[model samples]
Target chain A: DVKVTQSSRYLVKRTGEKVFLECVQDMDHENMFWYRQDPGLGLRLIYFSYDVKMKEKGDIPEGYSVSREKKERFSLILESASTNQTSMYLCASSLSWGDLEQYFGPGTRLTVT
Target chain B: EDKVVQSPLSLVVHEGDTVTLNCSYEVTNFRSLLWYKQEKKAPTFLFMLTSSGIEKKSGRLSSILDKKELFSILNITATQTGDSAIYLCAVESAGAQKLVFGQGTRLTINP
Candidate 1:
């Protein structure tokens, strides 16, 4: 079975603080993605990595950055957290970049106060 | 910009009923469309449609895509309470490694 795990299920941070959300996949997938889910907005892509050290910006990448230093791990960084940045963060992995089939990890609900 | 739209943002029905969820897309270099069911946690994969007129079935849930029309429909027959969740549709364009998701349709089933 494919397993995608996130570093935290819930988090709280104060404004101006730095936050990091981590995701790891055991399927050795070559594609990983970061998304944020908000009510009435669905899930919007924040960033994605196709290979180690290779990153691409999705539709909404402002105020966020990603790191993929290893094949199994992908990290999303909030340089400075803001109240409006609070959202449910999701991570997904796919076997190939061209494949639309993806497995998502349990989301992290972050509260930025 | 690539766009994915889902009709009837919310629906309420009773158990044993049948329902159809619709997804339409406007994208360049369209590759595939995917459906997912999300509960309180992460969204789980349901089906992937890349070809027109070919139906994908899993138990009571089935889906068919119309590439020529740029739309897809998911049908669930004899729905149960467990089938209640937010249904999401996403599209992938060529060379785009990420999926563009719609707002999702929230479904409720009462016994």
Candidate 2:
């Protein structure tokens, strides 16, 4: 079975602290994605990468950035955490560009205090 | 803006009852629609529909997509408490390789 692993399951950080969320996929999927899920707004795409070192901004990428230094690993960086930034973060990966079904990680719940 | 919407934000049913969840999307260059079941942890993949009029089924769960109407429906028969979860609908468009998801329908099955 394919597994996508996130570094942390639960995290708490200060409002202005810098935070990092990590994800690694066992499968050699070329595409990786990061999304933040909220109660009423659903899941909003934050960033994604199709190839190593190639990252693209999604709809809600304003306060987030991503790094794909390795093919199997993708990281989401929050320059400065805020109260509003607290949410459940999910990581996903797919084999190809048009393949819509993505394998997702267990998700990291970040709480900004 | 591309959007996905799910109906009946929440539903309650008995173990032997059948339930249907709805999802609608408005996106540019629609590629496909997907359904996922999210429990306490991550959401698990259920079905992916690219063509209209064809139904996909797995045991007690079945789904069908209608491209012309830009909507899909997921039906669950013989509901069980273990089947209780948040059902999410997402759409993949041509512009980006990302999936836009709906708010989801939270289903609760009573014993």
Which candidate leads in lDDT?
1
lDDT of 1: 0.95
**Where does candidate 1 stray beyond 4 Å?**
none
Model 1 CA RMSD to the hidden true structure, in angstroms: 0.8
lDDT of 1 at B43: 97
Model 2 over residues A1-113: C-alpha lDDT tens digits? Answer: 88999999999999889999999999999999999999988889999999999999999998898999999999999999999999999999999877878999999999999
Q: Write candidate 1's Cα lDDT for B1-111 as tens digits.
A: 899999879999999999999999999999889999999898999999889999999999999999988999999999999999999999999877779999999999999
Per-residue C-alpha lDDT of model 2 across residues B1-111, encoded as one tens digit per residue? 999999889999999899999999999999889999999988899999999999999999999999999899999999999999999999988867889999999999999
lDDT of 1 by residue, A55-102 (tens): 999899999999999999999999999999999999999998677799
- TM-score of chain A, model 1? 0.99
Please give the lDDT score at residue A3 for candidate 2.
97
Residues forming the 10-long window of minimal summed lDDT in candidate 2 chain A: A94-103
